[model samples]
Target: MNWDDLRVFLAVARAEGLSGAAKTLRLDPATAGRRIARLERSLGAVLFAKSPQGYALTEAGQRLLPRAEAAEAALAEGRAETAGAGGERLSGTLRIGAPDGCANYLLPQVCAQIGAAHPDLDIQILALPRVVNLSRREADLAITVSPPATQRLRAEKLSDYHLSLAASRDWLAAHGAPDGPEALKGARMIGYIPDMIFDAELDYLAGFGVTRVPLASNAVSVQLNLARAGAGLAIVHDFALPAAPDLVRVLPDRVRLTRAFWLVSHAGPRDARLDRFATLLRDGMRAEIARLEASVA
Candidate 1:
């Protein structure tokens, strides 16, 4: 089997669609589709079931997955070994999945430093509202508020981040800042949509007495932006405070919450590049956390 064709197959299997796989592999949809078709023909098997929802792997494809992944891992090990032999810095894409808040507030700077140190490395930061599945190879590493429960994954505490009630100066002046959570009743509150919150850790408003969120979005940045726009008060992460200096902390001492960031990766033989990259992430996160906490202080 052609390794290049198998690579395309692996991308399609993971993405579950030609277009998504194409985009990820930086190939046009036509090229990706053609490659898959060629691979299927060479193997004499239908690899995927086509449907409106997306591509679903056939039994043949499922059977081929583990072997493909093993080959990929071996290739990665070879690359790492080659780089080490040359006494060169690690090179390749390091994909990180993180919440929108962390991605927006913390990762850009961290990624910049990582990029500067390893000019050949490409860092792909997926800063989205939904969790990235490391098991599916969606990300090489993930920064999550909660650790994964799966035994196949290894997690380490990255840092503790603080969240507190905040509102814009204009909103506080017009509506008066709440003395505590109780006063938030009937207050214009910006938060995650009640039912759409992807992670339990994101259900921040549940701790408060208020059940309804008048203004809501799944994205943390959207909630913070709305708060800055004087729409309402929000439980904002301290790291984001630098972006909206006009946002006044409301009852910082009384209404405060802390969440731990965990660095998660799949369990397996350690890759030199991943280990070095993880170190960079840990140091960067620690520095950023200190900077953010100091800003609030």
Candidate 2:
């Protein structure tokens, strides 16, 4: 019946492991386990079934999930209301999940500015190569290359960014620039591993008839580094070009592609502070992309 116990239960359910839940809550694993045991004793029902894989919720645990989530949301709403009433700066944690490319190139500056304004805000950027799982509460918000297909999440287009074939100046100078996309067949290519691409938007080389990549990685930052090292031609984001001055577009006119970033979050009532933060994030990303792209142009 204790709200704190319910909070611990929700964390364990989402993380699917006591250690992970304990890490999130900043508690010792033994302490978290004891809390769960206490909660089960109070409810007179076993909540989790432990296994080698992890914790699996029991029927009783499943039943309590939604109600626990509602209580958590209500607590968040109350905090937001109190903060607004007092005109206090944004506090507590905000975790954002994003592909490594965006996380590395875009978010640091944007988040730094937000953090500067609200010194109390604790922002964590999870630069994961795969799509962030909002359903499991991996992150409070996510920036994705494509809009999520699920109805449980809401998506908003933040910006359209360009990408094109690029290679280091030295590489082009040594091997000669490709006359067009067709000439790329002879060049060493760097791109995402064919089977490892997590999203359709990340399959940047497929449309160009590129079925082979001699050098490949799932992470964009790694591909960029390969291109920068003069390993091969790779499709590079225009906004990211500023970071690698040695690299230049190879076939800008004939090989240009456009993609967008979507701000994705769980669909439901949210804290007003989150709403304001989202606005700042959206506007900041748009401006940063434009400014970076223009600099390279």
Candidate 3:
């Protein structure tokens, strides 16, 4: 039997009728019925019983489901692989998903390099709240602080960073920067929630040779917003805070902490554009981190 016939039968079986199958596959009722009829004839067995309600799978149809499903899966995979194989010029669209901070600090340079090297390529840099699954092809490339343990994917460390006790320039000016540990008690503290990895920055709080005024641990992203709005002092990842025109580092010596960045992508299909894109990102980010480190020093 033809794959189309089996596919129509499977859809009809699942959808419960030719009408539903046609709706699902964007086909007409007559077309779906014709294909199903052809498949049953080719198999020399009645695959379905049409009742007033819809199509119900017959014993023969039940037997054929597994084989038909396997064949459909194989065909889909073959089509994806064939479509994925393309030249090394990086002419197609590339989607890179990253956290807000990375998008702010690193993306511009990466975009510039990619644009210059591959003028025909369309680079879409999406700043998302969650990491998309590279294994499932949710994104072409992902930059994250966490990496998954999967053989189907490849990952690499991009750079390391510590947290910074930061606040807006207005907040620091009005509050008067506290220089010593004793002055921190009751200090308005902006913080990331305890579950986040950057919560390590909280370790350096008032008790660790420091005391803050009214300390609180909030989520990092939220804390950044609060800090920017001059709400309180947040221990932000050094890489997370873009150089804000209104914000400034406060109590830098009070919070000493560090973390790493990782780049992740799929290993299969070996998308040449993604490979070149990741290499470019690593190189650019490393240089930017070095410059920031020097400035921090």
Whole-model lDDT values for every prediction: 0.83, 0.84, 0.67
Task: Write the residue-wise lDDT of candidate 2 on 85-148 in tens digits.
Answer: 5566888999999999999999998888767667799999999999999999999999999888
Cα error of candidate 2 at position 200, Å: 0.7
Q: For candidate 3, which ten residues in a row score worst on lDDT?
A: 192-201
Worst 10 residues of 2 by lDDT: 76-85
Give the TM-score of each candidate.
0.70, 0.70, 0.56
User: The CA-based lDDT of model 2 is what?
Assistant: 0.84
TM-score, cand. 3 vs. native? 0.56
State residue 46's C-alpha deviation in candidate 2, in Å.
65
Q: Which of 2 and 3 is the better model by lDDT?
A: 2
lDDT of 1 by residue, 59-152 (tens): 9998996677567655644543344345566588889999999999899987876676677889999987888899889999999988788889
Clash totals for all models, in order? Answer: 0, 0, 17
Those runs of model 1 whose alpha carbons end farther than 4 Å from true positions after fitting are 1-87
What's the lDDT for candidate 1? 0.83
TM accuracy, model 2: 0.70
